[model samples]
Target: MTTQQGTALTHALAEVPGPLPTSGVIHVATPHTSRFTIVGNHLAQHAELSLTAIGLGTHIQSLPTGSRIGIKSLAARFPEGETRIATALRELEAHGYLHRTRVRLANGRITTRTVFRNQPGPTGAPHPEPPTPTSAPAPAPAPAPAAAPAPAPAPTSAPVPAPAPTPGPAPTPPATRGSVPVPAPEPAPVPSASRPAPVPQTHPPAPAPSCPARKGPARLLPQPRELTAELRQTASMLLADLRRHAPELVLSEADIERLTPATATWLERDARPETIRQALTTDLPQPVKYPAKFVRHRLTVLLPPPLPGTEELPPDRPTLVIPMQNCEGCERGYRSRVPGHCRGCRAQLSAA
Candidate 1:
């Protein structure tokens, strides 16, 4: 091949336009760069072959394997919702381009990691999987209940197999064997006083008795007070509402401890659960940094004042004195003491 000419395999496709026709609203299939063209073809081969999968796959494959790919980040970047983004990621996993492995760190913590490749077949990859922690061995089985000792056999004598013949010949009659002569006997004297008395027996003294050690009553520590059923239910309902409004924020136990009192404050102000939910969620920022604080502040500030009771209403009072009709002498309002005159007019007439 000459220096000016390029081989077919290594050569880049050179396209030259020739008197082309015009078209209205053109769609660009591939990006300007060659790497992107490869990526586009990679996505086309695998994936659910849907627009969403293609978009997500293209976005993911553009970055290195160990990149932080959060659901919210993808949702914001693409026009699709969070649910659609999550589904597309799963679809990518179904294809060979994506691999997600759950790794356990040495610190006894576990996390999921994703590995991405534009092409398939990681058959001889050298990365070793995280070690699986060994679980504690089960406790040695309760010593099998000791078998009861076998009962001792009762003592028994063997019976003779055969009867024995009568000893020698039959015994002679008593009369033949009997008969004898009499003899004289002499008397013996009592023992002398000098004979020593039988010696007395002696036994060793008994050893001192032993006393067992005494044990005192065991002392126990006090247990923490448990939350009542009603309070727990209320807290769960409030937290559920909070989670719905702020999905990104996770409340710890300490956060719950701080939020419980705020919930109580809202409850005391005659605020319904739905009202409290709306008040806290009304104009929430896209991402709330401190959910617990924001919720508590809203609950504390949105309280309406208490209404008055029936006892505070006004009582009955006496009517003021006024004339029903105006008098000819003076036109004034007064209680109708005189038929057609004010009190002053009546008094003046009486004086005249």
Candidate 2:
């Protein structure tokens, strides 16, 4: 090839869109025109989040509104299982990417509402600007001093002298009497003209009413009745011993703890330990993928009702009339309502 032609061909190759040359993973970019989710790098590349959490969050964001993302649902859809899915949800919540709140509806049903955020708030994400420091309010400007009244203008002329008292006042002075001296009245205070009037107190608007937190649904298994230390220990032992009956039925500590209460419920219902063992060990699936779930299912489905009390027994019962007695004549056992003789003695006497 000619040098100019080779150069032109190299330029064309460079212009063609292709995966960028890189040592590690390469990316072939494609624009998503119809359906796509835009995730911020802050969340996609979060330093604290694990790979499972990041992926789970991305999947949740892509789903449409009103989608079910519960632990069980997610577990069913993906192979991560319920436990890992639950942990990932918690991680997302801690990082402020998800929020779950239980709210009571007008119909009095309690349900959980979940909210997802693309960008976390101050609680989890870094704040761009430091909080403006709260400064003390500038002291209210001192009330302007009241202006002093202008000195009364000096009289244009000298004040007139008082007239002399009348000379004929001495008719008869009244006799002096003992009396208490009254205190002089104080002068009224002068109001300041520049001082502002007092402002009436205004109460802050009452906070919006909040709904009380209502309890969630009842547990899948019934609780043990009259729970006591002995009952709890017995249930725990029964669960721990199940592995001996069926080697494949081994349960973990968590499983044992969870099933203990249900087992205790069985004992409370008057079920014998042997009977419970038979119920659990008789039906053996070739492989028990989740031992705890299997055990829980059995416990719930096979739970017996409580035994009736003595008062509940029927009042009418069959009575036996014939009572066993020893014959006086021969000392032989006979059946009669009262003391009597054997048939042989009665026949011999009659013959005479």
Candidate 3:
């Protein structure tokens, strides 16, 4: 910090009226040297000692006067160890390094109480008497300069001619005797007024045409498909369709079983007969029962991407499921119905 800033900090510290708070310890990590300087300087000046005394004061007595005490004893005396430098200084102020006042009321009458220290002495040393001052003798002056001879004066010359002045109006003097008076001019003649001609009002130009609004593709709800003996084969076809057309919506082998019932129902209700038949045959089916339009809508609404890839197969795949087995709030398999407990068994649990 600049000297001016440091001085300002010191002034602010002095205005605080006491040492730093006990809790305001300077940490080893990211040490605040500026704050340390402010606190250390203030304590040193107020306690009438050096910075060393400020450090020593923390461990030994509340206030350390000189170098008579040992560090070991100082450390033992203060509970906070070496880091108690700030706390100790504050304790000293609290214990009377500076003055404090208190007001007390008894029988509705106020009484003032004052506390301070006026004398200064060594912490553990014997008291000494005040010293007297002695006056010093005056010094002698140096000798004067030597004498010199005089000389004759020279003759003076005549003055030169003054130059001619340039011509212009002379400045007028102020009207001292009375205020200056002036004549007023006559008013302008009024002219004959004429009626304004009628003019047709023009309408503002129409605004330019805007770009056509974009309409999102229609979202067809999934058709409800019948559960039959060919469920496994049908699921394989749906998986193939997802891979071929919407590879981004990757689902694992286990995910296929989990999603098949709902997907089949969706397809049966919404898809064409040919789309359903195609989805049932090939490993990589095209134009399958689950259309890209509907699948994209479902994925956008229900799942966050990037979706799981084909590499993450079957049992190891990340399942988009809410744990229902541990639920214990209601008889039904549903967990969403419970507000603050498991819906299945009515057991107290966290809200979803």
Each model's lDDT: 0.50, 0.66, 0.36
The true-versus-predicted C-alpha distance at residue 172 of model 3, in Å, is 74
Measured on C-alpha atoms, candidate 1 has an lDDT of 0.50
| CA-RMSD of model 2 | 25.2
- The number of clashing residue pairs in each candidate reads 4, 0, 21
Could you give the C-alpha RMSD of every candidate to the true structure, in order shown? 40.6, 25.2, 38.4
What is the C-alpha lDDT profile of model 2 across 152-266, one tens digit per residue? 1111111321221221221111110100111111111111221111111101111111233466664588798578888899998999999998988889898888888899999
Q: What lDDT tens digits, residue by residue, belong to model 1 across residues 210-323? A: 111355553232111444556556855686557666575467777766666556555554567877777767788777887766665565566555555668867768998764
Q: Write the per-residue lDDT of candidate 3 for residues 69-156, one digit (tens) a residue.
A: 3324556655546545444433443433322233347777653222212222222222233111011011110111011000001001
- Best-performing candidate as measured by TM-score: 2
lDDT of 2 at 94: 70
Q: Per lDDT, what order, best first?
A: 2, 1, 3
The better-scoring model by TM-score among 1 and 3 is 1
CA deviation > 4 Å runs, candidate 3: 2-5, 22-226, 229-232, 273-352
